[model samples]
Target: MNQEQLEGKWNQVKGQFKQKYGNLTDDDVTYSEGRFDEMLGKVQEKVGKGKEELKEEISNW
Candidate 1:
């Protein structure tokens, strides 16, 4: 998926998490987002793939 689609999906997941675990804060979500981006960057660097490709691969999992 593209950037917008990825972001939309993330938001949906975040919403679900917030609903399921009511104590989760925006800061918690933001920290998770940063971790995901960092992991994606590391994967991209190691595999020499673009961000979109990495996202697609991860989505398949």
Candidate 2:
């Protein structure tokens, strides 16, 4: 998936998370998003794969 697809998926997941865990706020989800991006960056650095390649690998999984 590309960036648009990733954002769409994130939005869907975020909505489901809020529905299931009513205490979660936008800040909470946004923080998670930031952490995910940070981790992805670290993985890219160590693995030497482009972000899109890693993203596609993850999506395939």
Model 1 lDDT tens row, 2-28 = 778888999999999999999999999
Backbone atom clashes (below 3 Å) for every candidate: 0, 0
22 Cα displacement, candidate 2 (Å)? 0.4
The TM-scores, one per candidate, come to 0.89, 0.93
Candidate achieving the largest lDDT: 2
The residue pairs that clash in candidate 2, if any, are none
Score candidate 1 by TM-score against the native: 0.89
Model 1 stretches with alpha carbons more than 4 Å out = none
Best by TM-score: 2
Model 2: worst 10 consecutive residues (lDDT sum): 52-61
Predicted candidate 1: what Cα RMSD to the true structure? Answer: 1.0
